[model samples]
Target: MLTRRTTHTTLALAASLSLAGALAGCAAEAEDSAATPPQPTTDASSSGAGDGSTDTLAGDAGTEYSDGTYTAEGSYQSPAGQENITLEVTLAGGTVTEVSLTSDATNPSSKQYQGQFISALEGAVVGKNLDEISIDKLAGSSLTSIGFTEALDSIKSEARA
Candidate 1:
Protein backbone atom coordinates (compact mmCIF):
# COMPACT_ATOMS: atom_id res chain seq x y z
CA MET A 1 0.00 0.00 0.00
CA LEU A 2 2.89 2.41 0.79
CA THR A 3 4.57 1.75 -2.55
CA ARG A 4 1.28 2.24 -4.42
CA ARG A 5 0.66 5.58 -2.67
CA THR A 6 4.19 6.81 -3.51
CA THR A 7 3.73 5.92 -7.18
CA HIS A 8 0.39 7.71 -7.32
CA THR A 9 1.93 10.86 -5.79
CA THR A 10 4.77 10.85 -8.30
CA LEU A 11 2.34 10.42 -11.21
CA ALA A 12 0.20 13.32 -9.99
CA LEU A 13 3.21 15.59 -9.71
CA ALA A 14 4.38 14.71 -13.22
CA ALA A 15 0.93 15.39 -14.68
CA SER A 16 0.73 18.77 -12.97
CA LEU A 17 4.16 19.76 -14.28
CA SER A 18 3.22 18.75 -17.82
CA LEU A 19 0.02 20.79 -17.66
CA ALA A 20 1.91 23.83 -16.40
CA GLY A 21 4.51 23.52 -19.17
CA ALA A 22 1.84 23.34 -21.82
CA LEU A 23 0.09 26.38 -20.48
CA ALA A 24 3.34 28.34 -20.46
CA GLY A 25 4.08 27.38 -24.04
CA CYS A 26 0.66 28.48 -25.20
CA ALA A 27 1.03 31.83 -23.42
CA ALA A 28 4.39 32.43 -25.05
CA GLU A 29 3.03 31.70 -28.49
CA ALA A 30 0.09 34.02 -27.99
CA GLU A 31 2.32 36.83 -26.80
CA ASP A 32 4.58 36.48 -29.82
CA SER A 33 1.85 36.16 -32.44
CA ALA A 34 -0.29 39.08 -31.39
CA ALA A 35 1.60 41.41 -29.16
CA THR A 36 -0.49 44.09 -27.53
CA PRO A 37 0.02 47.44 -29.19
CA PRO A 38 2.03 49.79 -27.03
CA GLN A 39 0.20 52.73 -25.57
CA PRO A 40 1.29 56.24 -26.59
CA THR A 41 3.47 57.71 -23.90
CA THR A 42 4.46 61.28 -23.04
CA ASP A 43 8.13 60.39 -22.90
CA ALA A 44 10.14 62.38 -25.40
CA SER A 45 13.14 60.08 -25.36
CA SER A 46 11.80 57.36 -27.71
CA SER A 47 13.33 58.73 -30.88
CA GLY A 48 14.62 56.16 -33.33
CA ALA A 49 17.94 55.96 -35.18
CA GLY A 50 16.88 58.44 -37.83
CA ASP A 51 18.29 59.07 -41.29
CA GLY A 52 20.99 61.30 -39.72
CA SER A 53 19.66 64.67 -40.88
CA THR A 54 19.22 67.46 -38.37
CA ASP A 55 16.86 70.41 -38.53
CA THR A 56 18.53 71.29 -41.79
CA LEU A 57 17.07 69.69 -44.91
CA ALA A 58 19.17 67.01 -46.51
CA GLY A 59 21.98 67.68 -49.05
CA ASP A 60 22.70 71.30 -48.07
CA ALA A 61 19.09 72.39 -48.48
CA GLY A 62 19.35 74.32 -45.18
CA THR A 63 16.98 74.45 -42.19
CA GLU A 64 14.48 77.09 -43.22
CA TYR A 65 11.11 75.32 -43.53
CA SER A 66 7.94 76.92 -44.80
CA ASP A 67 5.12 77.16 -42.28
CA GLY A 68 2.36 75.04 -43.78
CA THR A 69 0.94 71.55 -43.97
CA TYR A 70 2.54 69.12 -46.41
CA THR A 71 1.49 65.71 -47.67
CA ALA A 72 3.31 62.88 -49.40
CA GLU A 73 2.93 59.20 -50.15
CA GLY A 74 5.64 57.04 -48.60
CA SER A 75 6.31 53.48 -49.70
CA TYR A 76 8.07 50.56 -48.09
CA GLN A 77 8.52 46.87 -48.86
CA SER A 78 6.83 44.41 -46.55
CA PRO A 79 6.60 40.63 -46.38
CA ALA A 80 3.24 40.69 -48.13
CA GLY A 81 4.31 43.18 -50.83
CA GLN A 82 4.96 46.88 -51.31
CA GLU A 83 2.90 49.07 -49.00
CA ASN A 84 2.28 52.79 -49.05
CA ILE A 85 1.00 55.39 -46.58
CA THR A 86 -0.07 58.98 -46.98
CA LEU A 87 1.56 61.22 -44.39
CA GLU A 88 0.66 64.80 -43.66
CA VAL A 89 2.37 67.18 -41.28
CA THR A 90 1.78 70.78 -40.30
CA LEU A 91 4.79 72.89 -39.49
CA ALA A 92 5.03 76.14 -37.57
CA GLY A 93 8.37 77.77 -36.90
CA GLY A 94 10.12 74.53 -37.90
CA THR A 95 8.16 72.61 -35.30
CA VAL A 96 5.58 69.96 -36.07
CA THR A 97 2.18 71.28 -35.08
CA GLU A 98 0.12 68.38 -36.41
CA VAL A 99 0.59 65.01 -38.02
CA SER A 100 -1.59 62.37 -39.69
CA LEU A 101 -1.25 59.10 -41.57
CA THR A 102 -3.50 57.21 -43.96
CA SER A 103 -2.71 53.60 -44.47
CA ASP A 104 -2.87 52.21 -48.02
CA ALA A 105 -1.95 48.68 -47.17
CA THR A 106 -3.99 46.02 -48.95
CA ASN A 107 -2.80 43.13 -46.84
CA PRO A 108 -4.87 42.72 -43.73
CA SER A 109 -1.84 42.27 -41.52
CA SER A 110 -0.09 45.25 -43.04
CA LYS A 111 -3.16 47.34 -42.63
CA GLN A 112 -3.48 46.35 -39.00
CA TYR A 113 0.09 47.32 -38.21
CA GLN A 114 -0.16 50.56 -40.17
CA GLY A 115 -3.31 51.43 -38.29
CA GLN A 116 -1.42 50.86 -35.06
CA PHE A 117 1.38 53.11 -36.28
CA ILE A 118 -1.05 55.81 -37.35
CA SER A 119 -2.75 55.68 -33.99
CA ALA A 120 0.57 56.41 -32.31
CA LEU A 121 2.03 58.92 -34.77
CA GLU A 122 0.73 62.18 -33.32
CA GLY A 123 2.20 61.42 -29.93
CA ALA A 124 5.55 60.58 -31.50
CA VAL A 125 5.87 63.58 -33.81
CA VAL A 126 3.63 66.43 -32.81
CA GLY A 127 5.65 69.27 -31.26
CA LYS A 128 8.96 67.90 -32.54
CA ASN A 129 11.22 69.67 -34.99
CA LEU A 130 11.05 68.45 -38.58
CA ASP A 131 14.44 66.79 -38.41
CA GLU A 132 13.74 65.35 -34.98
CA ILE A 133 10.58 63.55 -36.09
CA SER A 134 11.97 60.25 -37.27
CA ILE A 135 10.69 57.07 -35.65
CA ASP A 136 11.89 53.47 -35.86
CA LYS A 137 9.00 51.93 -34.01
CA LEU A 138 5.73 53.03 -32.42
CA ALA A 139 2.71 51.06 -31.26
CA GLY A 140 4.52 47.77 -31.95
CA SER A 141 4.83 48.59 -35.63
CA SER A 142 8.43 48.87 -36.77
CA LEU A 143 8.11 48.38 -40.53
CA THR A 144 5.49 51.09 -40.76
CA SER A 145 8.08 53.60 -39.56
CA ILE A 146 10.15 53.00 -42.68
CA GLY A 147 7.28 54.20 -44.82
CA PHE A 148 6.61 57.06 -42.40
CA THR A 149 10.22 58.17 -42.59
CA GLU A 150 10.13 58.15 -46.37
CA ALA A 151 6.97 60.23 -46.35
CA LEU A 152 8.44 62.64 -43.82
CA ASP A 153 11.52 63.12 -45.98
CA SER A 154 9.32 64.08 -48.90
CA ILE A 155 7.32 66.43 -46.71
CA LYS A 156 10.54 68.08 -45.61
CA SER A 157 11.47 68.71 -49.22
CA GLU A 158 8.05 70.17 -49.91
CA ALA A 159 8.20 72.35 -46.79
CA ARG A 160 11.73 73.61 -47.36
CA ALA A 161 11.80 77.33 -47.76
Candidate 2:
Protein backbone atom coordinates (compact mmCIF):
# COMPACT_ATOMS: atom_id res chain seq x y z
CA MET A 1 0.00 0.00 0.00
CA LEU A 2 3.09 2.33 0.59
CA THR A 3 4.70 4.09 -2.32
CA ARG A 4 8.56 4.21 -2.70
CA ARG A 5 8.61 7.98 -2.73
CA THR A 6 6.60 8.19 0.52
CA THR A 7 8.83 5.64 2.27
CA HIS A 8 12.04 7.47 1.27
CA THR A 9 10.63 10.78 2.49
CA THR A 10 9.68 9.32 5.91
CA LEU A 11 13.13 7.77 6.45
CA ALA A 12 14.93 11.01 5.64
CA LEU A 13 12.69 13.02 8.03
CA ALA A 14 13.16 10.56 10.91
CA ALA A 15 16.98 10.61 10.60
CA SER A 16 17.04 14.41 10.48
CA LEU A 17 14.84 14.64 13.64
CA SER A 18 17.03 12.22 15.61
CA LEU A 19 20.19 14.15 14.74
CA ALA A 20 18.58 17.46 15.72
CA GLY A 21 17.46 16.03 19.07
CA ALA A 22 20.97 14.81 19.95
CA LEU A 23 22.53 18.16 19.03
CA ALA A 24 19.95 20.01 21.19
CA GLY A 25 20.75 17.84 24.20
CA CYS A 26 24.45 18.53 23.79
CA ALA A 27 23.87 22.27 23.47
CA ALA A 28 21.79 22.37 26.69
CA GLU A 29 24.50 20.58 28.63
CA ALA A 30 27.10 23.04 27.39
CA GLU A 31 24.94 25.99 28.40
CA ASP A 32 24.41 24.62 31.91
CA SER A 33 28.10 24.07 32.39
CA ALA A 34 28.94 27.60 31.23
CA ALA A 35 26.33 29.17 33.55
CA THR A 36 27.89 27.72 36.74
CA PRO A 37 30.67 29.72 38.38
CA PRO A 38 33.97 28.04 39.24
CA GLN A 39 34.72 27.70 42.92
CA PRO A 40 38.04 28.95 44.34
CA THR A 41 40.34 26.58 46.13
CA THR A 42 42.42 27.57 49.15
CA ASP A 43 45.70 26.14 50.37
CA ALA A 44 45.94 25.32 54.07
CA SER A 45 49.30 27.02 54.46
CA SER A 46 48.36 30.15 52.55
CA SER A 47 47.75 33.32 54.60
CA GLY A 48 44.66 35.42 53.99
CA ALA A 49 43.06 38.53 55.50
CA GLY A 50 44.49 40.62 58.35
CA ASP A 51 48.15 41.65 57.87
CA GLY A 52 49.33 38.44 56.15
CA SER A 53 49.82 36.67 59.47
CA THR A 54 49.38 32.92 59.23
CA ASP A 55 46.79 31.45 61.59
CA THR A 56 47.90 27.88 62.14
CA LEU A 57 47.03 25.14 64.59
CA ALA A 58 48.71 25.15 68.06
CA GLY A 59 51.58 23.02 69.32
CA ASP A 60 52.70 21.78 72.74
CA ALA A 61 55.85 23.34 74.23
CA GLY A 62 57.60 20.94 76.54
CA THR A 63 59.82 17.91 76.33
CA GLU A 64 60.49 16.08 73.08
CA TYR A 65 57.69 14.01 71.64
CA SER A 66 57.04 11.49 68.89
CA ASP A 67 55.79 14.31 66.66
CA GLY A 68 52.00 14.44 67.02
CA THR A 69 49.12 16.54 68.34
CA TYR A 70 48.11 16.61 72.00
CA THR A 71 45.64 18.43 74.29
CA ALA A 72 45.52 19.14 78.03
CA GLU A 73 43.32 21.07 80.48
CA GLY A 74 44.35 23.69 83.03
CA SER A 75 42.55 25.71 85.72
CA TYR A 76 43.21 28.20 88.50
CA GLN A 77 41.32 30.53 90.88
CA SER A 78 41.34 34.23 90.15
CA PRO A 79 39.80 37.11 92.06
CA ALA A 80 36.66 36.46 89.99
CA GLY A 81 36.54 32.66 90.60
CA GLN A 82 37.85 29.36 89.26
CA GLU A 83 39.01 29.74 85.65
CA ASN A 84 39.32 26.77 83.31
CA ILE A 85 41.59 26.59 80.28
CA THR A 86 42.33 24.05 77.58
CA LEU A 87 45.43 23.76 75.45
CA GLU A 88 46.17 21.96 72.19
CA VAL A 89 49.72 21.65 71.03
CA THR A 90 51.62 20.33 68.03
CA LEU A 91 55.04 18.74 68.10
CA ALA A 92 57.39 18.19 65.21
CA GLY A 93 60.92 16.75 65.22
CA GLY A 94 60.97 16.73 69.06
CA THR A 95 60.30 20.46 69.29
CA VAL A 96 57.23 22.49 70.16
CA THR A 97 55.65 23.71 66.93
CA GLU A 98 52.53 25.52 68.15
CA VAL A 99 50.24 26.04 71.14
CA SER A 100 46.50 26.76 70.93
CA LEU A 101 44.73 27.87 74.11
CA THR A 102 41.03 28.15 74.95
CA SER A 103 39.57 29.46 78.20
CA ASP A 104 36.27 29.03 80.05
CA ALA A 105 36.37 32.52 81.49
CA THR A 106 32.81 33.76 82.14
CA ASN A 107 33.50 37.14 83.68
CA PRO A 108 34.08 40.09 81.36
CA SER A 109 37.38 41.05 82.98
CA SER A 110 38.53 37.41 82.92
CA LYS A 111 37.78 37.25 79.22
CA GLN A 112 40.04 40.21 78.56
CA TYR A 113 42.74 38.69 80.68
CA GLN A 114 42.57 35.35 78.88
CA GLY A 115 42.83 37.05 75.49
CA GLN A 116 45.95 38.86 76.62
CA PHE A 117 47.42 35.65 77.95
CA ILE A 118 46.96 33.85 74.67
CA SER A 119 48.53 36.66 72.66
CA ALA A 120 51.53 36.72 74.95
CA LEU A 121 51.77 32.94 74.84
CA GLU A 122 52.50 32.89 71.12
CA GLY A 123 55.76 34.76 71.52
CA ALA A 124 56.73 32.84 74.64
CA VAL A 125 55.84 29.25 73.72
CA VAL A 126 56.20 28.95 69.95
CA GLY A 127 59.44 27.30 68.72
CA LYS A 128 60.60 26.71 72.30
CA ASN A 129 61.44 23.36 73.79
CA LEU A 130 58.50 21.91 75.68
CA ASP A 131 60.85 21.20 78.59
CA GLU A 132 62.06 24.81 78.56
CA ILE A 133 58.67 26.50 78.47
CA SER A 134 58.09 28.22 81.81
CA ILE A 135 55.97 31.27 81.26
CA ASP A 136 55.44 33.22 84.46
CA LYS A 137 53.25 36.13 83.33
CA LEU A 138 51.62 36.61 79.95
CA ALA A 139 49.99 39.92 79.00
CA GLY A 140 49.45 40.62 82.73
CA SER A 141 47.60 37.40 83.31
CA SER A 142 50.08 36.10 85.87
CA LEU A 143 47.55 34.17 87.92
CA THR A 144 46.68 31.74 85.12
CA SER A 145 50.25 30.48 84.67
CA ILE A 146 49.91 27.93 87.44
CA GLY A 147 46.99 26.32 85.70
CA PHE A 148 48.84 26.45 82.39
CA THR A 149 51.83 24.75 83.93
CA GLU A 150 49.59 22.06 85.33
CA ALA A 151 48.19 21.36 81.90
CA LEU A 152 51.68 21.26 80.38
CA ASP A 153 52.71 18.74 83.00
CA SER A 154 49.89 16.48 81.93
CA ILE A 155 50.67 17.00 78.26
CA LYS A 156 54.25 15.96 78.89
CA SER A 157 53.07 12.79 80.55
CA GLU A 158 50.50 12.04 77.87
CA ALA A 159 52.85 12.81 74.99
CA ARG A 160 55.70 10.77 76.37
CA ALA A 161 57.02 8.42 73.72
Candidate 3:
Protein backbone atom coordinates (compact mmCIF):
# COMPACT_ATOMS: atom_id res chain seq x y z
CA MET A 1 0.00 0.00 0.00
CA LEU A 2 2.84 2.46 0.90
CA THR A 3 4.82 1.70 -2.34
CA ARG A 4 1.69 2.28 -4.46
CA ARG A 5 1.05 5.70 -2.76
CA THR A 6 4.74 6.84 -3.35
CA THR A 7 4.56 5.94 -7.07
CA HIS A 8 1.35 7.99 -7.41
CA THR A 9 3.03 11.09 -5.82
CA THR A 10 6.11 10.86 -8.12
CA LEU A 11 3.87 10.62 -11.21
CA ALA A 12 1.94 13.78 -10.12
CA LEU A 13 5.25 15.74 -9.66
CA ALA A 14 6.49 14.85 -13.19
CA ALA A 15 3.14 15.91 -14.72
CA SER A 16 3.27 19.29 -12.99
CA LEU A 17 6.83 19.96 -14.22
CA SER A 18 5.85 19.17 -17.83
CA LEU A 19 2.90 21.53 -17.64
CA ALA A 20 5.08 24.36 -16.29
CA GLY A 21 7.63 23.92 -19.11
CA ALA A 22 4.88 24.04 -21.76
CA LEU A 23 3.41 27.27 -20.24
CA ALA A 24 6.85 28.95 -20.27
CA GLY A 25 7.36 28.17 -23.99
CA CYS A 26 3.89 29.60 -24.86
CA ALA A 27 4.64 32.81 -22.86
CA ALA A 28 7.89 33.40 -24.85
CA GLU A 29 6.06 33.03 -28.17
CA ALA A 30 3.35 35.48 -27.05
CA GLU A 31 5.98 38.12 -26.12
CA ASP A 32 7.63 37.72 -29.53
CA SER A 33 4.27 38.19 -31.33
CA ALA A 34 3.62 41.44 -29.38
CA ALA A 35 6.88 43.04 -30.59
CA THR A 36 6.76 45.60 -33.42
CA PRO A 37 8.48 45.20 -36.81
CA PRO A 38 11.33 47.45 -37.84
CA GLN A 39 10.45 50.53 -39.91
CA PRO A 40 12.12 51.58 -43.20
CA THR A 41 14.59 54.48 -43.32
CA THR A 42 13.63 57.83 -44.97
CA ASP A 43 15.37 59.10 -48.13
CA ALA A 44 17.18 62.44 -47.74
CA SER A 45 17.79 63.23 -51.42
CA SER A 46 14.11 64.04 -52.13
CA SER A 47 13.82 66.53 -49.25
CA GLY A 48 13.59 69.98 -50.96
CA ALA A 49 12.83 71.68 -54.35
CA GLY A 50 10.73 68.80 -55.59
CA ASP A 51 10.45 70.10 -59.15
CA GLY A 52 14.16 69.38 -59.79
CA SER A 53 14.35 72.70 -61.57
CA THR A 54 17.36 74.98 -61.06
CA ASP A 55 16.84 78.69 -60.35
CA THR A 56 18.42 81.17 -62.80
CA LEU A 57 17.89 84.81 -63.69
CA ALA A 58 16.27 84.06 -67.06
CA GLY A 59 13.87 81.45 -65.63
CA ASP A 60 14.34 77.67 -65.35
CA ALA A 61 17.12 76.39 -67.60
CA GLY A 62 16.38 75.23 -71.23
CA THR A 63 13.28 77.44 -71.54
CA GLU A 64 12.88 80.10 -74.26
CA TYR A 65 12.38 83.78 -73.44
CA SER A 66 13.03 87.20 -75.03
CA ASP A 67 16.69 88.05 -75.72
CA GLY A 68 16.37 91.55 -74.29
CA THR A 69 18.32 92.53 -71.16
CA TYR A 70 16.70 92.94 -67.73
CA THR A 71 17.83 95.53 -65.19
CA ALA A 72 17.39 95.58 -61.41
CA GLU A 73 18.38 98.45 -59.09
CA GLY A 74 18.91 98.52 -55.29
CA SER A 75 20.60 100.65 -52.62
CA TYR A 76 22.28 99.90 -49.29
CA GLN A 77 22.96 102.38 -46.45
CA SER A 78 25.37 101.53 -43.65
CA PRO A 79 27.54 103.26 -41.07
CA ALA A 80 30.24 103.62 -43.68
CA GLY A 81 28.10 105.32 -46.34
CA GLN A 82 25.32 104.78 -48.85
CA GLU A 83 25.86 102.59 -51.92
CA ASN A 84 23.72 102.68 -55.04
CA ILE A 85 24.03 99.64 -57.29
CA THR A 86 22.37 98.39 -60.46
CA LEU A 87 22.61 94.94 -62.04
CA GLU A 88 22.18 94.30 -65.77
CA VAL A 89 21.33 90.64 -66.34
CA THR A 90 21.38 88.95 -69.71
CA LEU A 91 19.11 85.96 -70.20
CA ALA A 92 19.43 83.20 -72.81
CA GLY A 93 17.46 79.97 -72.89
CA GLY A 94 15.79 81.18 -69.71
CA THR A 95 19.07 81.30 -67.76
CA VAL A 96 21.16 84.17 -66.47
CA THR A 97 24.40 83.96 -68.50
CA GLU A 98 25.92 87.25 -67.41
CA VAL A 99 25.62 89.95 -64.72
CA SER A 100 27.03 93.49 -64.80
CA LEU A 101 27.29 95.88 -61.90
CA THR A 102 27.24 99.70 -62.00
CA SER A 103 28.04 101.67 -58.89
CA ASP A 104 27.99 105.41 -58.18
CA ALA A 105 30.39 106.55 -55.45
CA THR A 106 31.51 110.19 -55.25
CA ASN A 107 33.69 109.85 -52.18
CA PRO A 108 37.26 108.65 -52.88
CA SER A 109 37.41 106.71 -49.61
CA SER A 110 34.11 104.94 -50.29
CA LYS A 111 35.12 104.22 -53.89
CA GLN A 112 38.37 102.55 -52.84
CA TYR A 113 36.61 100.37 -50.30
CA GLN A 114 33.66 99.61 -52.61
CA GLY A 115 36.02 98.45 -55.33
CA GLN A 116 37.20 95.50 -53.19
CA PHE A 117 33.60 94.70 -52.26
CA ILE A 118 32.53 94.81 -55.90
CA SER A 119 35.43 92.58 -56.93
CA ALA A 120 34.38 90.03 -54.31
CA LEU A 121 30.81 90.09 -55.63
CA GLU A 122 31.94 89.61 -59.24
CA GLY A 123 33.96 86.54 -58.27
CA ALA A 124 31.39 84.92 -55.98
CA VAL A 125 28.20 85.17 -58.07
CA VAL A 126 29.07 85.22 -61.75
CA GLY A 127 28.16 81.98 -63.57
CA LYS A 128 26.42 80.64 -60.45
CA ASN A 129 22.76 79.96 -59.70
CA LEU A 130 21.16 83.15 -58.42
CA ASP A 131 18.92 81.36 -55.94
CA GLU A 132 21.79 79.36 -54.43
CA ILE A 133 24.35 82.14 -54.26
CA SER A 134 25.24 83.57 -50.83
CA ILE A 135 27.79 86.16 -49.76
CA ASP A 136 30.20 85.88 -46.87
CA LYS A 137 31.28 89.26 -45.58
CA LEU A 138 34.90 90.33 -46.19
CA ALA A 139 36.91 90.83 -43.00
CA GLY A 140 37.02 94.65 -43.04
CA SER A 141 34.21 95.28 -45.52
CA SER A 142 31.20 93.88 -43.70
CA LEU A 143 29.00 96.88 -44.56
CA THR A 144 29.99 96.82 -48.21
CA SER A 145 29.37 93.09 -48.36
CA ILE A 146 25.88 93.59 -46.97
CA GLY A 147 25.19 96.22 -49.61
CA PHE A 148 26.47 93.98 -52.40
CA THR A 149 24.33 91.03 -51.27
CA GLU A 150 21.25 93.26 -51.03
CA ALA A 151 21.74 94.39 -54.58
CA LEU A 152 22.23 90.80 -55.77
CA ASP A 153 19.08 89.68 -53.95
CA SER A 154 17.08 92.40 -55.67
CA ILE A 155 18.35 91.17 -59.01
CA LYS A 156 17.36 87.57 -58.16
CA SER A 157 13.87 88.62 -57.05
CA GLU A 158 13.27 90.59 -60.23
CA ALA A 159 14.54 87.77 -62.45
CA ARG A 160 12.30 85.20 -60.79
CA ALA A 161 9.27 87.33 -61.63
Question: Which stretches in model 3 have alpha-carbon errors above 4 Å?
Answer: 1-68, 92-95, 138-140
TM-score of each candidate?
0.62, 0.59, 0.48
lDDT of 2 by residue, 5-112 (tens): 999999999999999999999999999989997775545456665465554323434334678888999999889999999988898766678888999898999899
Candidate 2 stretches with Cα past 4 Å from truth are: 1-63
Cα misplacement distance, residue 36 of candidate 3 (Å) = 26
- What candidate 1 gets wrong by more than 4 Å, as runs, is 1-62
Best by TM-score: 1
Q: What is the lDDT of residue 155 in candidate 3?
A: 58
Better of 2 and 3 by TM-score: 2
Worst lDDT run of 10 residues, candidate 3, spans: 54-63
Collision count of model 1: 0
By lDDT, who's the top model here? Answer: 1
lDDT of 3: 0.63
Candidate 1 lDDT at 99 equals: 87
For candidate 1, write residues 54-158 as lDDT tens digits: 342263324778999899999989999999999988999889999889986789999899999889889888988887766899999999999998988888888
